[model samples]
Target chain A: MPTLEDDDLVFRFPQNCGRSTFRIAFQRTLRIPDSDREYPLPPGLGTFPLRHAEDFPALPDRMAARGGVVMPMWQAEALWINCSHAGRDDLPVAVKIAAGKINAVTGEAWRPGLHRDPQDYVVAPDQPWLDGFASAPGQIRQFVAMPLGDGYTAEEQITGQAEWGGLQISVTPMKRAAWDRLRKAWWPGLGERVAYLHDNFDRMSMGLGAGGLMRQRIEEDPHDLADWDQRATERVFVSLVHAAQWSALTGQQPPTAPPSAQAYAKAGLPWFQHYGCDRPALPGASPLRDLFSVAELHKAQTGQVLPGSQDIAAELPVRPFGTRPREVRSPGGW
Target chain B: MQRSAAPSFGTHVRALREARAVEDSRFSLRQVAARCGVTPAYLSRLERDESPPPGAEVLVKLAHELQEDPDVMLAMGGKISDDLRAAILARPRLFADLIRALRDTPEHAVLRILREVRDGDW
Candidate 1:
């Protein structure tokens, strides 16, 4: 079950699975200009406040039954998923993240079980954060929020339907035996004491639509597929409620509006460039390749224009942040 | 999950170092050890808990280099800095009582007390 810990959703595994936990947070960030020019990664503003759907009145029964959480987003705000492990040496958990039932990596429809040929899910602790849909190699169209039923979401663009309008995440952890064997082989020097350290949706609100392209590579899984415990998967639905509806349903104020990409650039805040593992990157998904950006969709739907549609030319310095690549220590000698 | 016991001083130092290193490559083991005037081999042993935690000078240097509060680094090393030790020794009973009274309180409450002490009218 996933518990809200310090604003991050902490999914704890069963005792049989060594009780390792995965933490994920929905971070609010700048909505890059939806233009042909790919932009640098934006800075994280803060986490979007989340609430259990059951705590409020007038929630859809489907959401409650699926064990869903709710968070408010403005019509055009953007978000990114932040993934981490509770402790340093815990086993990596495979996470399948789909926005509105469309796989963010492969752009396939939501389905049970992990996929290896295309590698649909991300491995936590290895791939720390997912900013947006994998559009191409080392490039992702940023996730920008748009109201459902208007035909801007990846779900609507790909599926030709919008039945599910929220994010779905299911996690599968490594089997305990595999972890023990790997630990014994991988870290022979470290003593035993070190080992201990390890929806719904409703749609009524918004779903993720691809925005501008950013430089990000969704890494291919390094561990063998056999290591994952396929049977012990836990899934949750995240419903994105619009600010007004959220206030009406929960009777609380929604978060302030996010700053525009242009404004943020003008303010001289450092954009981020995450230096991740050197693993091979997955080829981008085809279904999501040609989806219209929010700006493009808005321009096509309504004759009126949105400001800052053209890519910002400002030279926003990119701040490099990443794990220093260490020597790859393999569990030698099978 | 509850931890079996509090982490050792070496474990805490390694965790802090690694956390910083993960955020920025400038804090890599060799880089931090070099910046803090220590050998990487010795630092690695200290991090892996094979060696005892270092004294206040190294801890203070590491705290400064890692952008952590010096007091926190000293406490994590299971040592009170000389100045703090002198202050405690000057009023041992009162300080002990104050520490005991505040130990069980939440961090926010302690922070509130700190703010009051800083902004209070003497």
Candidate 2:
């Protein structure tokens, strides 16, 4: 139950690309037990956990990796202030405030000064605690601090990083519809890739996906999962997505490639070649040997010969299973 | 079942001083500390809740400097009644450990424990 001090007001703004800039403006004032000296902040300045800070740094990377940036606006741009009484059984309520610029075109700043009128509102502690403080009336609203980090899933990671004093704020102007479309298109495929790795956990001994090792260990021993019971499996999946997306955005090479033929051979799995006319003798052919040959895999998977050549479809398998499947109509057509 | 109010005599004195725009009125911590006969660091700590309550004499002196009533300062600290204690206790973190334990428990088990605790009707 720490009290507010005058010096606690900290303002942070981005120094890089205009696309990444976000300003955090707040003032900390002491609340006397029964004083007439009341100061109510405007609705624009009241939003808790402002969105600009959380969305900026990761924007450039997201733009490059995911075609267009996906910024969660309404959910990400709120501001919050933490206030709790000392030695109280009740939890601290983080007051959420709504903030918006008077005019984005004018570029004006909000300077702290006396206001003749201010909006008054009361905020409950936790979402559930809202019931207890139903009758309480005050200009200040309360909010609960949201815990966030690596352990949280992508959806759960929406919470701010409180300890760093870094508010999870996003300043991007990307509309919700655009962001939703991008995420919808991107996530399903990403989930499939991650699921593939998880299913073939034993075969995946190396690579960025290998970090799933911890997850594999948890799945191996149910006790491990129970140790961190509050966490859900979706949280783990989110962490993997964050890790993979982060790597992709940063352009850092994945530590290892998907399991190679050698890795499969080591695991005592048969190595078979499905395509390519220049098939080497089968006696020593190992899947690990062909795993690194991306050029051949592409040719094999597509059933399309090299660009400059005139190889006909007759040369390849009549109906290659790996090639794109024929579009089928729904069984229950209108 | 009401508990006695805890003393917040210190916060009262500071708040009154702030309201009067006493000292430099520049909103600088250093100016306020100098006017209050204390070091800047100590004043900063007092404002941030790092130190315990300041003395009555100091409170009186701060009230005088701010041109506010000493009694007003004392009342603001909740020294006049025990209601303050109940209010403070009701604030968040009063049962932080218990809340955290409940939150950390397995979701299924937590429901059962909550049911038992509620059924016990404490």
Candidate 3:
């Protein structure tokens, strides 16, 4: 039995593995919050069924158009990290499809950092191999690395992944109860209007909820969800100043919108079927296409230096990391 | 009415071990065998129902280590302490709660509580 442990969760194969090669083990049954209620996540740890767009067999000629695919995740927050590269003339576009030892999305020099402490969890997107749905047009969003416990289900969760063997991609949602308390207090409760926002929203939109010092840092922001979301974005920008290394400069948090219909066309990223711009006519289309607007706003904030990585480990550990987060300048030293 | 055969002691051991695994990530069959002073092969035989139940001393040690009640495990192991069995059979719901507690609660903490219950009148 492949078993691994994280703080409150225990991930193990509940049944025989070789008997069924496709399934992934969950630490516990995920509690997915919805519009009306909270339900235990159904047994899902494999490829979500997918179909092709523009290929209606009956209408074959349309295939020449912007070729795309139809896909859906039970719960997902289509996110993108816009690295801030301000002053580097040598590096034109910091974001590249990464390969071995480098981040898949940002192309930052990423070697699995040695676990500095129990909290030093590395998200080895490739190890214990997984093949998930690709999001962008032409761009294969191999590992949709999002912070765990952000309320949003990551591509990793839906497609299935093996235990962290010690390498962990940090996912945080304080407690289901606490997440609800913040939601009930802040959201405009616009029903379906923002219901499209997510029964499981982004971690940035819901800043450090109710953590002692963490809560105090953002206490000054507006309590209303929309206003707070803007503040959260700004705070992410401000966190860049704390970066100690040049490569850390491009470190940005996950995008807030589902990728827009134009996400691939415009921003070079995938729009999550559920969270991005609504294409109501399609089979698995969603009504939440705000990522395009989000990307535009973020693009204005672009810089030449690489964005800095967020140090979630620093806060949750209740102390400094025993092994500091490893920092590299660039694939070649900047 | 037809009466069903009760599960054997080995079955109970397997069940408890699975529950213990949830709370203790590193808890393993090999580790259990070492603590029980038996070989992995022997413990595997017990869990697989190939061997007879172990002795009193081993059962009692397992209960202490796993933080279960020695008398209760002894009865479940087919040792059948009359007074203990009578008390447990009379309180089915209470016995269920005990099982839940054993599976859910940590060993050291549960043992401490069990100790207090044993020492105090309550």
Error of 3 at A114 (Å): 51
DockQ of each: 0.05, 0.01, 0.02
Q: Write the per-residue lDDT of candidate 3 for residues A218-255, one digit (tens) a residue.
A: 00111222211111110000000111221222233311
Ranking by lDDT: 1, 3, 2
Listed per model, the TM-scores of chain A against the true chain A are 0.89, 0.16, 0.18
True contacts kept of 2: 0.00
Off by over 4 Å in 2: A1-334, B1-14, B20-27, B74-122
> Please, what are the lDDT tens digits per residue for candidate 2 over residues B1-122?
35567545445545645654543364356766687788888876776667864666655555556555455554554343234446457874765666676854664465344211000000
lDDT of each prediction vs. the true structure? 0.76, 0.25, 0.28
Judged by TM-score relative to the true structure, which candidate is superior, 2 or 3? 3
Better of 2 and 3 by lDDT: 3
Error of 1 at A118 (Å): 1.4
Model 3 chain A — which ten-residue stretch has the worst lDDT?
A209-218
Residue A289 lDDT, candidate 1, scale 0-100: 85
Position A15, candidate 3: lDDT: 23
Q: How many clashes (backbone N, Cα, C below 3 Å) per candidate?
A: 1, 43, 31
